[model samples]
Target: MKTRKKANFFPRFHKLFAVKKIFSLLFAGGAAGAVNGLFGGGGGMIALPALERAGYPVRAAHATALAVVLPASLVSAAVYFFGGVPLAVLLPVSLGVTAGGLLGAALLPRLREGLLSVLFSLLMFAAGIRMLLP
Candidate 1:
């Protein structure tokens, strides 16, 4: 009979901070930040998959991607503000995004993993198509 080794949470967690892992994470984060800064959004298009590839579970990946992008988004918004992008133009979309974020958070836990994965893939596909079209 083959025996499976028990997973140790601390060791697994500690391994996440190893030098190579840290370098990979930094590279991914830099790419996401650059994309966000250049495009005004879409950091998650890079971040979520990066996090997943780094061994985060789907839910954790999504949550961590949000955390990773928030500061980049904030900095980009600040730059836009300095560049005189009008607040009036942003207010409505910001409000909608805030509401949608709240709703999505409330629903995330109840969503099936398969459904979430499919939806995420569809979103990425749509974004890629849109980018390629114009």
Candidate 2:
């Protein structure tokens, strides 16, 4: 039986363009953080692709993105809360969102990578179209 080897927590680079890789990583990280802070979510959308490009498997990338998004989300929520964004809306939405998040997290591991990619692409495309509409 063939065994799968675990990926390193930090990926190791071979004799490649190290400087460019570092710069790309820096840019991606900055963009993810900025998007999460400004939009109050979506770091994961930016982060998923960046992690995939950095050689993480799809499942790992998605999980890592949730880890990345969590703190950014908290900080943004705090800012909005203090800035007087209506807290009332949060109560209703948070319940559904929490349940949905749990369901999605539970389903992630069971999904095939190809199906997951297609679903994510469709979601991004739909979001883009929604933004372009009136």
Candidate 3:
């Protein structure tokens, strides 16, 4: 009686998974960057989960998302500035954002992971609903 040998497929499957992961990473970054440029914020809404799925802890993901958003925000702001957006409209908003951002950053580490996720989801849901309205 002749026995058929089975091929080892795990290595090939692992490589395919790695490739898919890389593509997901790139897609996440591109989406985040585009959102940042177009909306002036909300990149973090895209990036946070991406970072978390890429193996960062909840808090670390939030912080990393902020880090990614910062440069994109700056570039977008720079373009608006050079394109004649008024400092009168920008400065006060920027100051408020800075203060609020500092407070949120200080608060992030104090929150539990589940609470953070719930709050994040709620905020996103609210924003989505708000955007749907006139």
Q: Model 3, 36: alpha-carbon shift in Å?
A: 1.3
List TM-score per model, in order: 0.68, 0.68, 0.67
The candidate maximizing lDDT is 1
Question: Can you write out model 1's per-residue Cα lDDT over 1-134, one digit (the tens) per residue?
Answer: 12223224446655657556778889999999999999988898899988898888988999999999999999998888898866787899889999999999899789897988899999999989999995
User: lDDT: which is higher, 2 or 3?
Assistant: 3
The CA lDDT at 2 in model 2 is 21
Off by over 4 Å in 3: 1-17, 107-131
1-134 per-residue lDDT for model 3 (tens digits) = 12112124456655455656778878998999898888877888898888889887977987889898899888888887687877798899889999999999799779797978799899999989999999
TM match of model 2 to true structure: 0.68
lDDT of 2: 0.80
Q: Who is ahead in TM-score, 2 or 3?
A: 2
Q: Which digits, one per residue and each the tens of the lDDT, describe model 2 over residues 63-124?
A: 99888888878888788789885658877898999999999989978989798889989999
Query: Residue 44 lDDT in model 1?
Result: 88
